[model samples]
Target chain A: MTVSPTRIPEATVARLPVYLRALNSLLDSDVRSCSSEELATAAGVNSAKLRKDLSHLGSYGTRGVGYDVEYLRYQISREIGLTQDWPVVIVGIGNLGHALANYSGFSSRGFRTVALLDADDSRTGELVAGLKIRSFDELTAIVHEHGVAIGVIATPAAAAQAVADQMVSAGIRSILNFAPMVLSVPDGVDVRMVDLSSELQILAYHEQRKSTLQPDDGVVA
Target chain B: MTVSPTRIPEATVARLPVYLRALNSLLDSDVRSCSSEELATAAGVNSAKLRKDLSHLGSYGTRGVGYDVEYLRYQISREIGLTQDWPVVIVGIGNLGHALANYSGFSSRGFRTVALLDADDSRTGELVAGLKIRSFDELTAIVHEHGVAIGVIATPAAAAQAVADQMVSAGIRSILNFAPMVLSVPDGVDVRMVDLSSELQILAYHEQRKSTLQPDDGVVA
Candidate 1:
C-alpha cells in the first residue's frame, strides 16, 4: 500500500499513469477483476513487463483469480500521489496552451489549473476553461495564492528558458514543457519535455527504415 | 554507412532525435567541434551514454580533438533518415490539430503535413496553416496522392480508434496519437501516443513526492 517514490524506476514511474488509465476504463465497464495479461493488453505492454512494473509497488495479481481492478487502481493512484489535489499554472497562451487549458484529463486526475499566464498583455482577461488568462508578471502572486507546485510551459522556443527560470523563482518545482527547446533547471526540479517535433522525427526515422527495406512496396496510385 | 533499423535499440532511436536537435543548435552558433561532454550536456544525457549511443552508429569521436560538429550532425541526421521528405496527415482540426498544423518543427525536421482531415463537414472550408481542412472521407485519396506513411490523430478519444483504423486501411504505417485512449493496431502499424493528461500526471507524481519530502519548507508568505 505504501512505496517510496525513490524505489520505483523512472521508466516504471512513467507507465504508472498508463496503467491507471487502463484500470479506469476497466472500472467504467464494471469489470471487478483482471488477469495480468488482460491488464497488460489494455496497457499496450507485454504481460511480463506489466507484472514486473506492478511488482515495484508490491502489486502482484492472484495466481488464478487475477487482480481486483478497483483495488489495483486505487493502489496505483495512491502510489502516484493522485489522491491529493495539485494546483498548476500554465504559461504562454498560444495554440498549444489553448489545447492544454481545454484538456479535461488534468482536472479528472487531481490537477487543477489555478491560472493561465501569458506574457502578452492583450491575452489577459481572456477566458479559457473557466479561468481568466493573467499576465506572467503575476506568477509569483498566483503561485503564492494557489500554492501551485507544477507549471506548464507552452511558449515558443526563444522564450521557454526564461519562462522556466521565472517558474523556478516562483517556487514551481515540476514543469511540463511543450516548447521544442532544452530547459535547464536546478537539481531536484523535474522538467518533462513533450517535444511535438521530436516525436514526429522519431516516427519518421522508423518510417524511413520501413521504406528502405521495402523500396518497391506500397507504390500507390 | 548503412545500418539496419533492427540493429538500433528503441531507446537509442528515441534519443537520436534529441542529439540531432542539440547538434542543430550547435550548428546555428557556428560550433564546428565539441567534446562528448559538451554535446551530452546539450542533449541532456550523460557523456558515457552519448558515447555508447553514437558507437552503435559506428561513430567514434577522435581522442582529445572530439567530434566534428557538422560531421556528427550529418551522421545522426542520415542515421535517423532526416535527409528525406516524409509526408504526414493530421486528422481532427480541433485545437490540438490546429496546434500541430502550425507547429514549425515538423516541416523543418523532414515531416510535411500533406492534408488536414476532420469528421465535421463545417470544418471543411476552414483554413489552418495555409492548408484547408478536408473531409475525413478524403483520407485514402490524400494518403495515396502524397504517399503519406505517417498519420497524426488528434480526435477525441471516442473517435481516435476509428481514425487509426482508417489510417491503417489507407496505408499509413506509423501513427502519432494525441487522443487519450489505447489504440489497437495491427502488427505492422506503429503507434506513438502523446497523452497530455498522462504527462501532467507524471509531473504531479514527482511534485507530490517533492512536497511530501519537504513539507512546511516552502510555506511562502
Candidate 2:
C-alpha cells in the first residue's frame, strides 16, 4: 500500500542495462555492495544521476549505506521483467535476421526466440538455431501455439508492414520493428522500432558537425 | 551578441524530436502557434514536463503568448544541429542495408546516404541507389572523397568489427551499428547501435509482466 511513488522515468528505464552491466562487473570482482558513486563510475555515469535513477524504483539504498550487490541485481532484473521467460518470434531469416537468430543474449536471458519465419519457399523447413525456418503462412499458428505475444520483424522494409499486420492479426501486440518505416499500429499494440540507418544518420549529423566545426577533424580528400 | 540558451539538457534534447513531430502535425493542420499544454496534448506528453523540457533549450515561449509553431520548430531544429547537411556511408549491404538504401527520410532530413558498401565481391558492382555498390576495398578512397565521417554497419556480427575497424582506419569517427554485437571503438568515436530483436524482447518481457500485473501503466511489450 505504500508503493505510491513507483513511477520510474522512461529515461531511467533505458539506462537500466548500463547499470546492470556495471553491477555484473562488480559481482564478477566479488564486490558485495556499492554506493551510487562506485556504481556510476563503473557504468560511466555520474553518482547523482545514478542515485536519482535508482530512487525512482523505490528507495533501495539506506542513508550512508551502499546497496547489496546481489540484492540490487535481482531487484533490477525483476524490475525489468527478466525473471520470467518470454516467447519471441523473429521473422525474416535473412543475413540480419540470421545474425539475430545467432545472438547469444536472447536465450541466455529470459527472452527466447521460439520461431524463425521467412516468406521464401527455399528457406522454409530449413534449419536455423536447430529450429526449422517456417513460412510466414505458419505465423498465426506458431504464435498461438508458442503463446508468442511478441514478434521481431527483420524483414525488408517492403515486407515489414505486411509482417506487422500479420503479427497484429495473429494476436501479437508487441513488436520490435527493424524495418525503416513508420508503422501505424492500432491502439494497445506497442511497436518499438530499431532503425539501423537512422541511428547511423543521426550519428553522422553530429559527426559531420564535429568535423566541420573542428576543420582538422577530416582527412583531406 | 545575445543568443538563445546554448546548453540544453541531454534528456530534453532527446524529447525535442517528439515535440518536433507534434509541431509538424500542427504545421500540417495550418495551426500557427500552440501553448505548451496544446503541444503536450498533441504529443501524448504532460504539459508541465513539456514546458520544463523546452525551458532547458531557452524561453522559446512567450509568457502568455505561448510558442510560435514554425519559429519554435526552426529553433529546435537548429538546436539539434539538424540545420546542416551530413553525408553518410552504409557499410555491408544486406537486408537491413537495402532498407537503409531506400529510406527517403534519411536524405530528406539533413542526412544523406552518400554510398553503400559490401565486402562480398559478387554483391559489389551491383546497383541499388543509382550509385553502384562498391567493395569494401575502396573504403578509404570513398570516405576521403565524400568527406564522410558517419558510417552505418549493416553487416553480420562477425564482419561488424572489421567494418568498424576499417571505418576508423579510413578516418570515420562516428558509427551507427545495426549488428547485434557489441563493438569496441577507439576514443572520440561515437558508436550507437540499434538491435532489432533486443528492443522487442525487452517489450515482450514487460508485456508478459503486464498480463500478470493488473492495470499496468507503461510496460509495453
Candidate 3:
C-alpha cells in the first residue's frame, strides 16, 4: 500500500517498528501468519489498538486467516523506510556512545553507523564496532559523502545542544538523542530523546503505587 | 489535592517525569514560577495537554499566577513517587549494562542502584560506577535487603528473558529493559523495553518522508 507517510499519526508511526519486531519474531519461530490478538500480544499492545495502527498503513488482515506475517512485516518495513540502508553518524564516543556503536540491533534494522565522531582528540583514532572514531569537524563531509539524514547524539547533556546545532548545520534532519537534556532544533529537524533515567522513573512510579496499595506489607518497599 | 494513584492515565503517568525534569530545569535557572505555556514548552508539550495531565494529579495552577516552580516540581516528583529513594538492581554488566550503571541521571532522580549483577563469574567483584559487580545468584538476597522493587535488565537478547524471570522470582515487579527483544512477564509485572534500533527506525520513517516530498532533489539519500 503506497500510503503517504504524512497521513499516519505520529503515535502510530512510533509503533510501526514495534509491530515489525513482533512480526520478525513470529517469522523466526516459523509462524507464517498470526491473528491480530497474537501479534498484539507479541507487541505488548491490545488487538484493537494494533488493528487500528495497522489500518493507518492500509493493511487489513483477512477476516479468517489473519495477517500474513511476512507480508505485514514487509509493509511495515517499507513504511518505516527500512527497505533501504540508512547511513548514520553518531557523535560522542563516551560510554553510552560506545554501547550504541557496539549495539548489533542497529545494523540488523537497516541503520549503518557510517562514522563515530568525538571532540576528544585522544579518542579520535580509536576503533569502535569496526569504525574509527573521527573528529566532530568531519560531520559535514561524512553527511555529504553518505547522504546521511540521521544523526545519533550520545553526548553529555552540556554538549547535546552544540552537537544538535552541528548536526543541523551538516544537513542532518533526524536525530536520536541519548543525552539527558532537551535539544532545540530548527524547524523540519526532528529530535527524539531517549532518557534512560526517565524510563526507570516511570517504572518507579508504578512500583511506588504497588507499595502504596500494600502499605501494611512493608516487606515490599 | 489528594488523588488516587489509579486515577492518572498511563499516558499522563509516563509524562509526569518530563514535567518533573522541566520543572527541575526551571528551578536550576532560578525561576520561581512559570505559566502553563512556559512549562509546556520546556517539556515539549502543548499547554492544554500539560494542564490536562497535571489536572490528573489534582494540581491546577492559579489563574494568571501560574505554577510555583519548586512546588510543582515537588508535586510531580511526589506523584511519580520520586520523593523517596528507590532501590534498584541492574542485571547484566556488558557494554550497555556498564553504560546504564554509570549513568548519573538515575541517582539524581531518586533511583539508587544498590547492586549490579552479572552471570559471568569472572566479572564479579569488578567495580562499575563505584558499585561492585555481583553474581546473579545474589539477586534474591539483594532484593530482600534493599527492598528493591525495580529491576533493570541490560542483558543481551538471548539472556533477557532469563534475567527477567529471575528478577520476578526475586520479587521485582518493575523492569526497564534495554534488550532488543520482547519479554514475557506475568501479570502485575511491568516491563518497559527501550529498543535503541526502534527509535532510529522511527526517525528513519520521518527522514524518508522528507526525501519523498522532494524526490527531484535526490540530495537526501
Question: Who wins the lDDT comparison?
Answer: 3
Winner on lDDT (2 vs 3): 3
Candidate 2 lDDT, B1-221, residue by residue in tens: 23336344545655676677678778988999889999998766789999888876664588788999999988777766567767788998865687677766577667778888988989878988776899889999999999886888988777899899999999998888777656778767888877554474457545755576555564432
Worst 10 residues of 1 chain B by lDDT: B212-221
CAPRI classification of candidate 1: medium
Off-target runs (Cα >4 Å) in candidate 2 are A1-9, A19-79, A89-109, A113-143, A152-173, A177-205, A208-221, B1-4, B25-35, B56-68, B216-221
lDDT of 3 at A117: 98
Model 1, A129-207: lDDT tens digits are: 8989999999999999999989999999999999999999989889999999999999778899998877787787777
Residue-wise C-alpha lDDT for candidate 3, range B77-147, written one tens digit per residue: 88788889899999988888888888989999899999999999999999999999999999999999999
TM-score of 2: 0.71
Error of 1 at B118 (Å): 0.8
Candidate 3: where is the Cα deviation over 4 Å? A1-6, A214-221, B1-5, B214-221
lDDT by residue (A17-135, candidate 3, tens digit) is 89999999999999999999999999999999999999888888999999999999999999999999999999998888989999999999999999999999888889988989999
Report the TM-score of the second chain of model 2 against its true counterpart: 0.89
Task: Estimate candidate 1's alpha-carbon lDDT, on a 0 to 1 scale.
Answer: 0.89
Q: Fraction of reference contacts reproduced per prediction? A: 0.72, 0.34, 0.79
Q: What is the TM-score of each candidate against the true structure?
A: 0.94, 0.71, 0.95
Q: Mark the regions of model 1 whose C-alpha exceeds 4 Å error after superposition.
A: A1-6, A214-221, B1-6, B214-221
* Candidate numbers sorted by lDDT from highest down: 3, 1, 2
